[model samples]
Target: MNSTTQATLIKVPAVTLGFWIIKILATTLGETGGDAVSMSMALGYLISSALFMLLFVAMVLWQIRATDFQPLRYWATILASTTVGTTLADFATRSLGIGYGGGSLLLLTLLGLTLFCWQRLLGTIDITSVSNTKAQLFYWLTIMFSQTLGTALGDWTADSTDLGYLFAAGVFSGLLLFIVLLAYFSHISRTALFWAAFVLTRPLGAVVGDFLDKPLAQGGLELSRYSASAALLTSMLLLIILLPQRAALKTH
Candidate 1:
């Protein structure tokens, strides 16, 4: 592909083991980093949500303007989604008094609607087809919804359902593993499985972050949120440096 043609290709990284690893790291950081601002610093969910939203918007715009898939830019956008998702979910559930159940249901509904609209408009919601501006917009919207839904779902499993953090993390992680199996062994739709796996990873990260930071009295390690966030960010950066991230090759 020539320069212009290559430039028109999807500006997103292909899905791979490395992709998922970074995703989990980003989500985990989103959880702890968001809590650091909102809980530790007492910014409250609304203010923290507002702050993260600004970051998300800025990162997304930067990604949109790029000519090709840059690992740093793409992953930064993903991280922004997780951070914003954390606070937005918390605000919906805790501050808004929707509870985890209500917030999750609402987020799920919104996610379903976004996917439905994207599929209806493009006739497919596969990441492989996310090359154009509108499709990219839809793609990011789906991601934001999934991230927010993940937080609420994770909190619901851990707190509302009384499953506790470890169990909740286990549940999400098991679901992700099942999705991976289906992707490899089953004839299920790859696109559907991809989305399912994407959504499940967030909850796993959410619970893990909570387990790290919550008090011992609440069955947590009570680690410092800033410390956990920094550790996760470092790990993600190192992995990004070690891994090769490239956009999907245009085969069609």
Candidate 2:
């Protein structure tokens, strides 16, 4: 392929069942891993965020330089973002003393700002057009912020709103179903709907993970975090191995 062709060849994975499975598993692991470090290990949110942010930077650099979509590397980058998101949300809600509602509001604002800036700079927010380095950078930035927002939103619904983790998960899941319906039945832009669904899945995973690990008194299953994390990770690995992986096709 010529330089022009390569320039338009975005390194992205096809959207499939495997993609969604790995995404949810990664988000769930994010919750467990974040809690393991910040709450269980008593590292505190600030320290945890700092640590994961460094990991995010390292992984993102690796991801950018990669010539093609390597599943392990790409998912590792996603995992880093989710882990960072968990700690960042915790810091916003606790150390910063913003509380769940306040932290969620602030993070939502940041998410919106990131999207707005991306749209302004790129002139489009379609994932299909994320072919160049600049657009890829913006895509990841939006993802990081969206993950953080999802964490805060999950916590807000579970704690401040007293909906409990399971209920909160249900609410988010319902919203996801609605989004799917819209994508199928409505004239809404598929690109926009895709991003919206992607962002919503993070929170759904967050609440579901919390629901499994939190204490019984807190409306959780009282499961061991390590056990839950291991199970999810194993499932994700199995799916990734069993399913066929395909790179995004050249549109033109």
- Please identify model 2 stretches exceeding 4 Å from their true place: 1-8, 250-252
Candidate 1: which pairs clash?
A: none
Write down the RMSD of candidate 2 (Cα, Å). Answer: 2.1
**Model 2, TM vs. native:** 0.94
lDDT of 2 by residue, 66-169 (tens): 87777777788999999999999999988889888888888888888888998998888777667778988988999999999899888888888899888888
| Clash statistics: count for each candidate | 0, 0
Q: Give all candidate RMSDs, comma-separated.
A: 1.6, 2.1
Candidate 1 accuracy as TM-score: 0.96
Please write out the lDDT profile of model 1 over residues 85-189, one tens digit for every residue. Answer: 999999999999989999999999999999999999998998878788888889999999999999999999999888999999889888998998998899999
TM-scores of the candidates are: 0.96, 0.94
Error of 1 at 205 (Å): 0.3
